[model samples]
Structure formats: structure tokens, C-alpha cells
Target: MGAEQIRRWESGALAHAVTDPFGQGPLPWLRGSEHYVDATGQVVPWYAEPDRDRGARGPRTADDVHRQIKGFAASGAVAPGQAIDFHITVDPPQQFSVDIYRIGHYAGAGAFKIITSPRLAGIVQPAPLAADRTVSCHHWWLSWRLQVPSHWAVGAHVAVLTTADGYRSHIPFTVRDDRPADLLLVLPDITWQAYNLYPEDGRTGASFYHAWDDNGRLLGERDAAVTVSFDRPYAGAGLPLHVGHAYDFIRWAERYGYDIAYADARDLHAGRVDATRYRGLVFPGHDEYWSVPMRRTVESARDQGTSLVFLSANSLYWQVELGPSPSGVPDRLLSCRKRRGPGKASLWREIDRAEQQLLGIQYAGQVPEPHPLVVRNAEHWLWEATGAGEGDELTGLVAGEADRYFPRTALPEHRRRILLAHSPYRDGSGALRHQETSLYRAPSGALVFASGTFAWSPALDRPGHVDSRIQRATANLLDRICKRD
Candidate 1:
């Protein structure tokens, strides 16, 4: 598309502007892969292709174990008409193809296949270059450059890279738009990059949280990276560890026809997004990292009556700063000392900015195993239906890391505060701990909710993990946020 055409599409001035077609009934354009049909029946799938092989599991070879086909997006997100570069490396030097899919509720098809690249030769890129406590691939060769189509819908997207030998991996990125929507879904891209230990060959992989000693002994925060780069692929299969949490929420929300826009966390730090423009800002995954500007913006938005929803635990815990890439692309480097260091990087709580002061509840402890989510304020509007009552326990609803209200912490002033779920779980040390899901109405009439468990979003849509009551409760919260209730 030409520059003017792309601009028109982004400005929503095109004759057939892309839109969320879910829950709009089965229109003629929804038939087949074409989610949007323009005049003269020009159909655009917009990455809505189902039945494409998205699996990366196969028999392993020396090349697969040592260096399988893997890649990373040059940027965490790209707007329509912008070109995104994929840096990929394939072992044994083989040809590969990339299939791009936009993730959403496509009438329950899960994703739409938007683009497929012609087969291209792939080469093993250079090894990761290690700097002071950091590993980066800024020198890797660009394998593919995709110019995002102007009419592509805004949502979470993934690129599946498959080699001639059937080895596959994924590269995830977001297609963003500048238009306003009822709610903004910000993916935890910074946290994803923080936990990525690329080149996990048992020798030189290091995230901001963990690393391996020269003797291959696993080391903790002390030996971890003080800074992490966005230029390297995620360890293992190139997928972020907690990405499914965000995807599950997206599938459920889109299925219900919520008006949602997507962006990466870095977008908030870069001031590319205006949180105040939306009714609610949704963080639907393991969003554990935060920059000063990001926190200030979200908090400022809340003070202005924009609701904030955190669907998982341990959010805004660590403070981070963004830096330019070695090549000077802004906000490509994430620096968090996680302790007293040369820069202002530490836990927000340690700096007297306890997350509870904003979230109403703060990180408490980790759940060693799944535990029932014991309902507390069952009479609250958040639990209006789905047959939940006080003391009712949703089996295995509380797991992974969790949060709870801290009595001594400086809490956010609110018109009303409620503890929705109080669940007991044993920690790794066999100590008794409790997790509490919280909801508080800010003085500005904005609602802030903390799910207090990592499993909340998974229960929204993941098969074998879905819970109707939890789903209903989440819908209630979101509906209230959008004033649809």
C-alpha cells in the first residue's frame, strides 16, 4: 500500500476500515477467511487463518538441541504501514518460511492467518555477544522484513517460523493503532524480555533473574543480568513463558465483542500511548516490571477516572529504565539493577512505593501448588451471577504467585474497598500463606482490581482450565469498567 493509503487506513478513513467483527452476527464477509469484505468483494483475511500448523514440537536432532530454528522481532510492536524486521537463525543452514497469525476470538477459531512469506534461505546467525552482565544479538542478520498491511486489525500477533526439516518456533509482536478504544490491553513485553534466557545451551544464557555459572551451576539474582536486550529470541521455542495469560484474556474478551486496542508495555514508557484516552487499561498477564513513567501514567489515568485492571499477580514490583539499543533505537534496552546500583533501579516497594498503594493489594508469597479460591465478598456485584456464594471455594483457582492486602502498607484511598477472594495455600517452605483478590473504587470513581493469582487469566479461556464462575466474575468487572453492566 502507498504511504497515503496506509495513513488513510490507520486514520479509519478507508471505505472498509478494519474492525472487531466478533459478536456482530455472521455477516456475509465473515464467511471463509475473509473477516472484512470491501466494495467489489476484495477480501482481506488479516491473519485469521486457522488450521495452519502452529506446533513447534518434533523429533530432536543435534542441530535442534544445539541451535534450532528461532527468531525475535526487531521491535516489540509495529503500527500499520511500518516495517518490522525479524532476526532469525536456523541451524544447519536451511530454507524456512514464516506464517503470520493475528491472535483473537475469530468465531472460536483462535487466530487468523494473515500473511505467508515465500521460502527464504536461513543461516546460523552469530552467537550472542555478552557485555557486562547482559547478552545481546544486536549484530544478528535480519532474516525477514514484513511491511504491515494498512488494513490489518489491531491485536496480538505471532509469526511461526518453520524450517525445511519441520523444526518450528514462534516470534510474537503486536500490531498497534492510534485510534481510541474503550479499553487498552497492554502486553507485558518488558517482563517477557526480562525473563528470556536466549541461547539456553546450558552455558551462556542469562535473563535479568537467573543465569548459569561457568560450572553450569544455576545462579540467582546475584549473577543475573542487570540489563536485558530486546534483540534476542526468547529461550527454548521463542515464545514468552507467560504469554498465554494475555492470549487467554484476549480470546475471551474478543469473543464477547469488547472494544479493545493493543500495545506493548514499552509503548507506555515511550509516551506513545495515552492511557487517559481509554475507559480502562487492562494488564492481563504476568506484568511484573514497571518503569517510572509507566507507573506515573497509569496512576495518573486512574486519578482521572480511568479504571485499571490487573489480571495476574506481582505487577509493578520492580522498577526499570529504558535505554537505546546499541544501534540507538530508542527504548530497546531494559535496565533494572534489582538492587542498589549505579542507577535508580530497585523494587518499587523498597523505595516506599509499595504496589499496594495503588493496586490495593501487594505481592504476598508464591503458591507451591494449586489451591481453591475461597470466595469472600460473594454478595458484591462482581459475583452477581454464576451461583457463587460466600465461603465457596473455586477449586485450583489460586496458584503460581499470589498477592494480598497488607494492613500496614499505605493503601490507595478509596470510596470502597473489598476483598473478593481469600485463599489459603502452602508456600515452598510449607508455611501457611493467604492470597486475596482485591477491588477498590478510587475517589475519582475509577475501579482498580487485582486478581491476586497467576491462574486468573488462564481460567478465562484456556481449555481444561476454564471456569464459568471465574469467567462470569471477570466479565462483570470488565463490563463495569466499560459501563456495559
Candidate 2:
């Protein structure tokens, strides 16, 4: 319901305690500071309630930045015995202790830590250059490598780097799981990094849609981040967006003892997954940016009978390219050329790959106000045992963002087509429209389900704000799908 409640539930998903949940300890650069920036103009101090000066930036001592730590890799995943890279900023070069803890339910103690890397030492250096200078891409030099112990269980790992004086910052990554399971959950790492407004300056600190110039004008197609890198810390959460949405889905799945593996979007782009090994592949939340290869792989898997679930809205919309990162890793540099032309790479619609054709629904625009989802086809198998009926309202299910069916678009072949929720929304042009949550069966016997809203996953946790109707609906589907697979 509330942010703190969602966080407590997530924190309990862990088994035991290691350290207090990672926080911004002693870091001086904060997003809500008073500062302003102008294109071709100087940086000045300015703070306004409306944040009228979008790119306004404040001053930071070089020493304050030196104490910050940033982990850089295309994905947080690293195999046991594998080493991950991270950077640190501290003035005059001092030795700091590096600790690695696996964040998971340890025997039900909730978010406990096991000392994977205990008391390791490294020299902290000056913070990396903010490469773009205008954007928040911090190209911190590689400070150290953390090798995972071969015996550690596969889960999310948080790297806590602390100076001798105890100043600290948390860097998070995942331990790769190559094992087969009935379901695989993908944390939208690429999308998260794309939206992260680290060093939250108004002008240069944005993803494709996050830019605002000093004049309070949104960045144009060309001015937006043409290329974004992963070599930086998230402005908050160590991950962008939430511990409650996708992360909560993870806790729910795990708490129930469902067999699941974790990976990021890059794994899909790189063809690292044997999708056939699992019954379903899940895109957890706010999964927007996609590469050509990522789409092809997911499409192929779905056509071959593997179930695909998108637990969030605004998915597979933008077509981006992952260029070479500075570290020579592919898919590190996210490029979105949101424009029209023969050579232009932008939205999926512009490239003629309309996501609706595969998803059976397209972006209808976003629902601004919190509203209820009107169930359109309650008899559908997904509604089994939920006691829902046609015309019944599912409160708080339509929120944050939403998508509606595109009539003119070609949809995949299906035996049973059902619209679960019919809710209203407005497009970027602010025209009144609606979003629909739909389900259909493919020719190959695959079942495709899209939650059609960003709020769906949080609803799964039944956070007091929403009822158990959503929770019951999700469990019914997950049980049937995993059992069949």
C-alpha cells in the first residue's frame, strides 16, 4: 500500500539479517538539491517547488563525490566464482572494506546477509568523470573486483563498500542461475538504467523520456539521451523504481516455493536463455526498451509453446540498440533514436514491428488518476476461483500507466480471446481513451497474459489499497501454468 509497508514486506522475503537494508550512507549528492543548469549556460544554485528549472544542478565538493561507489556491468548477474566490477570515490586515495551479502530469506529471518566477501580491502579513488557532462552517466574507473564464492546460493547480491571511517554506498547485482525451472523472472535492468536519473540534473540527467532543459522544456528527439551507459549508481533504490513491484513478485514467487530463475533483459538480447527449458518467461515491470534480438527470441519462444507473461504495462514499446560499453561489453550502451525515417531506430511502431502484433494489445496511453478495472470477461480461466463476474470492479488495479487494444493492428492467432479489464486513460495528446487487460491462446498452445497496467504486480501483494481479487487471479494462473509446464 504505502512505500514503507511495501518495503517491509520485501525485506521480510529475505531469510536472515546481515546489515540494515542498504541506504544512502554519507553520500553527499542527492537528487532533491537546489541547483540549476542551462544549455550553453553555467550551473547555478536554484531550488523551486515546481522544479521550474528542470536541469538545475547544485555544487558538490570533489571530496564528497570521492566517497560514492558505483557498480558497472550490463547486468547484475555473475556466476559463482565469477568476479564483478565496481568503482569508488574517496579523496587522497584511502583503503576501504568491501563486503558482499546475498539478499534473500535466510531461514525466514527476512533479508539476512551471509558474508560472501568479508572485509576485503581496496583503494578508493576520485569519482569517475561524468562522461556526458550534461547527463548523469558517471564513468567511474574500475576500483575492484568481487569474486563470488562457489557455494553461495543464486539470488540478488548487494555489494556494500565502506570506508575505514564508515561512509558507505550499496551496489547490487545478481548471481546467475543456469538451472532449469518452470518459470523465469526477468528484472527489467535495461529499462531501469534507462530511466534512472542519477546525479538528477534537469537537462542532462534523463533517459529517452526523462529530459527537461533549464527552460523547463522536455528534451527533443535529438537532445534526449541517444546513448546511456550502465556504469553508474541508480539515484535511489540501488535499482530504479521499486522493491515492491517486480521485486515483490520475486519475494512472492520465492516465498511460495515456486521454482524460478532470475535474469535481466540483456540475457534475452544475448540469446543466453534456453527458453524452451521453462514453461514461462516473465517480464516483471515497466519493461519498455527492447532490442531487435530480444524481441525475436521472445517471439520464437512464445510461438513454440512456452508461455509469456508481462506483469507490467508499457512493455516492448521502444526499439533500442545496445552498443558497446566502454568496458567492451555488448548491450551496455543503450541507444534510442526516437524518430522517423528509413534508417531511424525508434518506437516499435515506426520500425513496422508494432508490439501489438505480438502482444495482442498496444499502448492506448496512460491512466492518470487511480481507478478501478472493470472486468469484461470474468468467465475466462484466469478469473477462476476469484469469484469475479462481468461488470465487477477491481479497485486500484488500473494505475500508474495502462494500455488498450489497437483495433486496426493485427493480433496473433488465438482460440479464446478475453478482455479482463476495460479502463479509461489518456494518450500523450491527452485524448480520452481506454486500456484493456486481455488474454488469448496462441496457435502453438501458448497462453499470453499482459497485466495491462504498471500497478498489477503491486496489486498481487494485496497491499491494503487493493483487494484479494487480483491476488487470487494471479495465483490461479500461476498454478495452472507452472503445473502444465
Candidate 3:
């Protein structure tokens, strides 16, 4: 059967009638055995479905993110007046301290911070796991009551977490002294097209799935490297599921602005969403796959001053669409069969236009082996503050073991484009391979910061403090684009 058929089957398109139509009550779940062992190991034939929908049990694994969130809600039995409690369980559980601050604009003071929780607390070291344990779980939890005084202008706040290694992570939450509306995060969902395999299933294996490179074993037949949750299609009605890279970016965006929102590209491709609402559009890490509508909407949004940031390299490579399906959500959305054959509009063309107007630099193509090291150009803005000019110092982050550049050219006539940064790109010293990252400004004044390197913000993951330069550079870009024309 085709993907469409699978969706229809999952959606109950073909239902079977029950023989006991005269049943006076709800039917019991059929079990082969007449009796069963209960949770307590006693002989109990049946018990309620373990009201898991409520605060049924504590989290057991890292996959309990959803359950932990539920336990904090009234429906989950967090007493009416009790504070909201949430927990994040991870493997190799580590301890960390997080401080929540209230950030907002009061009159003309601009953005200011007010300590909201735990009071002037210092570094909080988390409880360590058992010493004997080798492979267990770590659970980090934060619980607090909502109490914000009146007269505080509404805005967003940051939950700055500091790990033992001195690495700091930011989680954003909003504080409204008025009615609360859900904060929307617009994520470019690309979990379906997870791997970059040449022959589609080059690394495919049976028995068990191993997430190559990371060794973060997925541990299941359904656990494809895909980060976006696809356990059962449309399980959430395509409710803007964030995954992998997009999750990190959205978390970052929330700390800066609470108005950010996202929808799956497939949803947009299927015409199930309206993308014009957001004031800014963010294309996070390695968004190489793009349906026709995804490209068109983003392109249109950029022209209308919807600030676009392509925080990635080799983006928009594949051309996909909302495939034929009957499920509530779109199926077969991303359709770029790399080695399967080639045809139709290439992402190269899209990059060409984008470089001419918005983000500068058409993705020439992926660089081959023997990665070249990046050498700063005189025009690169990042070098101004570092005082590390050409041949003086090398960049901190490297791409693909070495740096790679996109194949680029000058923007079209009258197109004011700028090359922000570039690295020495050549084909293996033997082949004729050539690529470079060129930043440019469009005719409408939209700015693009292209850094042929894919590892643009690797410093963000450092285990203690955020790189001040990286933060400043990113913040500066946002400030520049959000300015009133």
C-alpha cells in the first residue's frame, strides 16, 4: 500500500462493525487470559487504565517530558492553589541551578530584569545520581507558584540555568499581568528527512537502531534517526511539533521574544497553516529540505520585513511537497530522493534569489573531503572586535573537521550585497572544488550573514558560560533587523 493508504488506515477510514451492537455499557479490553497480575503483583484481573492521563506515576525515563508537564497542571492533580511543578529527566543525570528573572519594558526604561523566584540565590549544585550506577537517569526539576504583582508591564523572562561545568542554558517563559495566551513557536519541522545518507538507506540495519556518531542508541525498530516525533502520524493533529535543531533555536528565541511561534513545514505545505502571522521567520540549523510552499512563504515574508535568519549552511537543498494522504496531518511531505534520481527546481536556484535579495550566498553545494580551514577576510565583521585579522588567528569553531564554503557569486545588478565572512575554499588541492560563504544585502535592504561554515554557533553548547561574542553578534543581528524602517 502507498503512504496515503497507510494514513487512511491509521485515520479509521476503514472501520469494522462490532458484533455486540446491543451492548448496554462500555466494552472491556479483551485479554487472552482470564486473570492477570496487577502492579502490586497480586492476582487482579483488572484495574482502571492507570489514570496516566492524570498524575498517575512519576517519570521513569528521559522520554517523560510530556508526563512531567502534565503533572504541573490542575487536570493532572496539582492541587488547585499549589505551585506548578515540572521535571526534565535525562540520561547521565547532572545537577544544575537555574534562576528565573522577570524581564519587561517599564515605561521608557526599555528591558530590565527583576528577580522573581528563589530570591538572591547562588550557584545551586544538583543532587548526584548513585555512585554504583553506570547507566541510569538524571532528573532535574523546578516548581514554583505564580505570583507577579500588578503594575508590571507584560513581557518575557529567562530561566538561566548554570551547570556544574559552568555551562549556562537559557529557557524562556512569559510573565503576563493580564490574560494569558499561549506562546507559539514557529519551527521548521524536518524530522522525517533525518539522515544525510547517499543511497536513502545506506546505514539502515535491522535488530536495533543506533544513532551513528553520537552512540545515543534510539533502542527500537521505530527509532529512526529522525528527531521529530513520528511514532504515530497526526497523533497531535500536527500541532507544531519541534525537534532537534529547531527545538534549540525556538528555546533561544523564547528567551529573547515571547511572541515567536512555529508550524511544521508539512502542515504549511498541506495548506493547513497560515505562516504570515509571525513578525519574524527563523530558519534554524541545517534546514536543507524545503517544500515549494515553504520556500515561497519564507521568501514572501522576508520581502515584507519579516526578518529571516538562516542560522545554517547547505540549506534548502531538496524540493518536496505535501504528498497525497488522508490523515489529519500531511504525509510524505519531504520528497527529495538524492540518489534515487534528479529532476525539477534545485535549491541552488532558491539560494541564488535569496542571495540577491535577503540572505546573501547561493549554496554552491557540499564541500568534499579534506576540509579547508577558515581564514578571515578583511570584510568579516566578527573579526573587528576580536582584533584577530587575517593570518593572525584562526576561528574557534571548525566545520566538518575542517571549514567548508558555499559556492557563491556577486548579487545581481543594483543589488546591494555584502560578504560578511569567508574561508579559503579549494578542491582538495588536486580537484577543482571551490566554495565560499558570501553575505549580501538585498535591494529592499534585507541583510544576510553567510559564513560558509555549517558549525556557526558551536560555542553555545559549551558547559559553563555562553560565549559573550557569539551572544553579542546574534543579538546585534536581531536588533538590526527589528529596527523600524
Q: Top TM-score: which candidate number?
A: 1
How much is 485 displaced in model 2, in angstroms? 12
Candidate 2: TM-score? 0.78
Off by over 4 Å in 3: 1-186, 196-244, 247-253, 256-259, 267-279, 324-328, 331-333, 341-359, 364-396, 401-414, 425-435, 461-466
- Candidate 3 lDDT tens digits, 84-175: 33232222334444445433223322224454344222222232222211111123243334444454444334444333333333333333
* Candidate models: Cα lDDT each: 0.80, 0.63, 0.36
Better model by lDDT: candidate 1 vs candidate 3: 1
All candidates: CA RMSD (Å): 11.3, 10.6, 18.0
Summing lDDT over every window of 10 consecutive residues in candidate 2, give the lowest-scoring window: 13-22
Residue-pair clashes per candidate: 7, 26, 14
What residue pairs clash in candidate 1, if any at all? 47-112, 47-113, 47-114, 48-112, 48-113, 49-112, 49-113
If both were scored by TM-score, which would come out higher, candidate 1 or candidate 2?
Answer: 1
Q: Write the per-residue lDDT of candidate 2 for residues 181-256, one digit (tens) a residue.
A: 8888777777876665553333334555444456534353455566677766654324454434665466556667
If both were scored by lDDT, which would come out higher, candidate 1 or candidate 2?
1
Candidate 2 RMSD to the correct structure? 10.6
Off by over 4 Å in 2: 1-69, 73-76, 91-110, 120-127, 130-141, 162-168, 201-204, 211-222, 340-342, 425-431, 462-466
Better of 1 and 3 by TM-score: 1
